[model samples]
Target: METTPTEKKSIKNFFAKLGPGLVTGASDDDPSGIATYSQAGAQFGVKLLWTALLTYPLMVSIQEMCARIGLVTNHGLTGIIKRNYSKPVLYIIVLVSYPSITLNIGADIAGMGAVGNLLLPGIPSFIFSLGFTALLMFGIIFFNYNKIAAILKWLCICLFSYIIIPFLSKTNWGAVLQATIIPSFEISKAYFMALVGILGTTISPYLFFWQTSMEVEEVRQKKLIVDKAVIHGMQTDVKGGMLLTNIVFFFIILTSGTVLFNAGIHNIDTVEEAAKALQPLAGNMAYALFSIGVIGTGLLAIPVLAGASSYMMAEVFDWEEGLDKKFHEAKGFYITIIISLIIGLLIQFLGISPVQALLWSAVLYGITAPVMIAIILHICNNKKIMGTYTNNRISNVLGFATLLLMLAAAIALIWFLLK
Candidate 1:
């Protein structure tokens, strides 16, 4: 079939409008995400392969709502919530989410340095962590929003190595296909824990705040005033980005299932563990490729973790925020980001296990996520705030379902821990 000129132009314009979603999706596969997926592949093999498929729609729907909220209101989530709800509500969210997100930033920075050390042996992880932190702080503080967006988009390409490396391995396509299609699982504590980790990593809370804030930033970048038409386009961009995100997630599990699962290596505590285990079955190239992906994702995720916290704090206090402004213009925003990086670097020097820290942060995020979702759902549906843009029945159903599932997961995790 021949394509029409209009269709071609539409495609061109679509690519041109892609920004927030792509970055959000790419950052979804950060170092912590890599560890979670790798652990899933190693421990359960393909048993939990269905999770990536199951979580896709939920991820898209929730993120789309967030993007929509930001676009329609032209305010960050915190700012919107602060206006709609009581001070107690706002304080509770900021207090819980701020520390949890900052801790996640520390974990990601630590992971980034650890992965960097893997790529460049003999270099200290602490040095790499501090150096990377400084670089990120400087980049975000000095660079304009356009430059930061460009850098992030380019960094997303590093994820392609996962796609390439999996193919190089001697994979059993037949088994991979079967595992992906059939959602089989072993009934055990370990398997259950891995499932929680997978869910926590995939359907994360940070992505929610980051995605919405980025949508506002996107509109600001294009100088588009917030209105119905603009919000509609922003929602479209978000959906497109989420679709790309889930597709990459599907492949991450597929690659891990084929390479890590097939090798009978059931324990993977870190990204490096997954990489090392793939050496015999996937060859040296596989290790190198996986390491590269981790490095790229680490770079992408750390900034987001730090930035999201900064956005939350700045919004709560009515301080200027957004990369679109200069340091003098957004002093509080820039300072929040710097403090986050500094604290994160300082944590690396505390002799804590980075992997363990990442795991605890994931658990904390799981616990805090439900509260944020509740506030988001409530605020988004408020007629006075959202006008006709309030979530429709379908959106509410999906959003509520996500909230319930996250709450359940948190409870289950706590129960499991106590036992």
Candidate 2:
């Protein structure tokens, strides 16, 4: 079955249209996300697999709104808030966002380093962490936006490894189908906590900033006019990206649920642990693929995390900023990125547990997500800001639904934490 030229051209065209959305979606399943999904599958089996299905449309709606905001205003989410909203509002948003995003970066870097060490025992994990940090810094500062984006785009293939891992294991397709389509419920604090973490991970504020800014960057680099066609393309890219994200998520859960849970290996705390556990149970191939995927996703995600923070800071302070520009041209932006990576790397040496760091980050994300979603909805609906690009009725419905859902998740998380 050889592909014809027409099929090849269509496939190429599909990938060509996948810019910001594709990369963004791929980045969402970072090491931290992999760990979360792994934990869910290991601890609860396929009970939570339905979340992957549930979050798809919600994610698409929110991301589409963010992309639309970026296309219309030519500014990142932070910039839009800074311009139209009050000073304290913007400051509060930034204040809550930095720690969480930085902590997430740290956890991911640590996960990557741990997995690197797992792959090759001779090298110390910190050495691998340092090497990766330096590699990311070099690439981000030295490479232009187009090259870096292409690298990230290609890195998306790493997620396919996860998709393949499930098939390597003896997965029960009927059980997986039942878990995916039929929603499951549990009345426990831990269940709700995991649910909150998954929600926070999937629909994050940092992603909102990144998506909006990347769309602006896309338009500027290509000089694409913001019209119906452009908006439609952005929507398509976002939908494709989010669909990819959820599919990878589902498969990861399926792999762990079928392999680890059935083997009585529950409670996976880290990506490395998940991989190591897979080796003896599911075989070496599963372990190797999972470990490799962690590193690849780290490469893809760390930049997005650092870049999101940098973009937010640059936008708030009105500094010259862009991944498209040279480091010298956007010193503040590049400096913020470097500082984020540095802090993230240093966090591992501070004796903080990666699990605790991830937990706190999830908590912060839960807090900020609802507020940001509300603000985004307000911005997208405000005629003064969006003009004709204001969200349609369907968009508004989905947008508000996402807001209420996150708000509920946040409240539930807080209640459980205090309990």
Name the best candidate (by TM-score). 2
Clashing pairs in 1: none
**What would the per-residue lDDT of candidate 1 be over residues 1-419, giving only the tens digit for each residue?**
99999999999888777788778888888877787787777776667777866777777778888888888788888888888889998887778777767777777787777777877879987788888888888899999999998999899888888878767866667876776677887778888888887778877777888888998888777878777677667666667767766666666676677777776777777777777777778787878888888878878878888888888899998998998899999999999989888887777678767676776787788887888888788877898888888888888998899888888888878878789
lDDT for each residue of candidate 2 in 215-301, tens digit (9 for 90 to 100): 999989999989998998898899999999999988898898899999999899999999999999989998999999999999999
Candidate 2 residue pairs that clash: none
TM-score of 2: 0.98
Give the whole-model CA lDDT for all candidates, comma-separated: 0.80, 0.93
Candidate 1 residues lying further than 4 Å off, grouped into runs, are 1-8, 225-229
Please state every model's RMSD to the true fold in angstroms. 2.0, 1.0
